[model samples]
Target: MKKILMGVLCLSTLLCGCTKNKDIQIDDKKVGQVKLKFDHIVGAKKLVLNDGTYSNNSNETFNINILKYFVSNIKFTKTNGEVFTIPKEESFFLINASQSESLQPTLNIPEGEYQTLEFNLGVDSLTNTLPVEKRAGVLDVATNGMYWDWNSGYIHFKIEGTSAASPNASKSYKYHIGFFGGYETRTVNNNRVIKIDLTKAGISKVQENLSSDIHLMVDIGKVFDGPNSMSIATTPMVMHSGPHSDIADNYATMFTHDHTHNFQKIANNEK
Candidate 1:
C-alpha cells in the first residue's frame, strides 16, 4: 500500500511522537533568530526549586531534589572566523530545575555576526555512544535528567543542597560531573568559552532584526570553586583528577557577564 502510505508520510514529519525533523535547512541562511537564554542562580538571588527546596536566601534552604542536564553542541562564530555548528543531529539541551519555566530558554538562529560561542555541558562522545530515544525537552530520555542511573553517561554537573558539610558519607553531594576519558575531561576540558565578543557586547548592531537581550550569570560559588567544595550535612564528590579537574576548570572561569541571570536573553527579535 505504497509502502504503508509512505510510512504515514514519513511519520507525519516527526512531531507526533517525534523522531525529530520538523524544520532543518541550515547552510542556506534566511531564517535568522536567536534568543537563546537559560539563566538560573543562587548567590546573588534568583533560583527557586521549591517543593523539593532550593529557595533563594530568605534564610537559605536547599534541596534540588533531582535536577536534569544536557547542553549539547551549539556553536556560532563569525566575523570572518566562520563557524556555525548546532548540529549534533540537532543540538540537544535539557535543563530542568524542576521547570521554573526552565529558566528563560530560547532558540532561533539565522542571521550572523558571531564572534564565538561553544557548548557541550554534557552528552558528548557522539550522543554518549548513541542508541538514541529518550525524548521530550533536551533530548528527552523521558524528560532530561541527563541519565547516569548507575554507570552509563551524561551528568556533567548537578548541584544539590542541605549541607552542614554533608558527610554521613554520601546522601547527595551528587556532583555527578562527567567525562570519563582524556582529551575531553580532567586536565583536558572542563571547558569554558562564552566569550561572545559582540563588539564587547555593548551592542550596537550586528545585522539586527529585533530581540537581542543577552544577560548570562551563574556563579553558584563558582560551582564549588576548587575541589568542588561546598558542603552541608555532607555530600562531597569531585572525581575529575588533574588537580581536581583543574579546580573544575577554575570554577567554570567564574562565568564572565555584565548584568545578571534568571531572565535570560538573546531573543533577537529582528527587523
Candidate 2:
C-alpha cells in the first residue's frame, strides 16, 4: 500500500509539471506588439522641415518644406528562422515628416526575437492598383497628396524644398517618385524592397506585456548622394516623367538600424 501511494504521488507531480510547461508554451505563443520608429535626419543632424538648413553631398544647402514616403508589406524574421508578415490591410503606412503621429508605425506579432526586418519602401503593385474603396485610410488619395489621378499610380516618395543651388526661378526642388511597373505599359519601377539585419544593432524582443520599438535612422542626405549621386542644381525637378532609377537606388540605402528598445511597457492606449 505504501509503494502504491508513493507511485500515485509521483504521477500527480508529473501531471502538474506538464500543465505548467504547457502554460509556459501558451504564454510564449501570445501575440505582442512592435513599433517601428523612423528618425529622419540629414547626415548626423535631425531633420527639421521648413526652417533647418542642411547640405547634401553636392554641397547644395537646402531647407526641406515637405518630406513624405510610404512604408508597406512589413515582415519580421525571427531568430529561429520564422517569418511573420503583417496582414496586408494593416501593413500600409504613410510617413510624413511634418506629422508627429505618422512617425512610428505599429505591428502586432507573436512574441519572439526578430533578427531581420523587411519592408517595401513604396506601395506594392497590387495595393496600388486596388479599387478606390479598398484604398482607404493613408492610401486614400483625398486625404493626402501622395496619389496621382489614375495613370501615374501613387507617389512613393516626395521631397520638396528650396535650395540656393537650384537653377529654378523659385529656388525650389521637387522630387516626386512613383512608378510600380506601370498599370498598362511597363515603366521605370522605383519601388524598392529594403531589408535590414537587426542582429548587429539589436534584435527586437517582443513580449506579451511589453512592446518592442525598432529605432531606425533615415539619412535624407543619401537621397542626393548614394550609389548614383545627383545634384540639386542640375536635377531640380524629378517628376513622374523623368528618369528616377538613380534616385531610387540612392534612397534605398537611406535606412539604417540604430537600436531596439525591447523592454517598453505597453501603453494603456496602445493596449
The most accurate candidate by lDDT is: 2
Question: Over the stretch 175-260, how does candidate 1's per-residue lDDT look in tens digits?
Answer: 55666343344324443334444445433112223343445565554555434444443325554432445444644554444532
Candidate 2 weakest lDDT stretch, 10 residues? 19-28
lDDT of each: 0.51, 0.88
Candidate 1's clash total is 30
What CA RMSD would you report for each candidate? 17.6, 9.7
RMSD of 2: 9.7
Quote each prediction's TM-score: 0.29, 0.89
Q: Write the per-residue lDDT of candidate 2 for residues 1-271, one digit (tens) a residue.
A: 9999999999999999776121112245698889999999998899999999999888889989999999999999988898989998999999999998899988889888889999999988898778888788999977789988866489999999999999999999999999888777888788999999999988888878777899999999999978888899989999766658788888999999999887688889888
Name the Cα RMSD for model 1. Answer: 17.6
TM-score, candidate number 2: 0.89
> Candidate 2 lDDT (Cα, whole model)?
0.88
Clashes of each: 30, 0
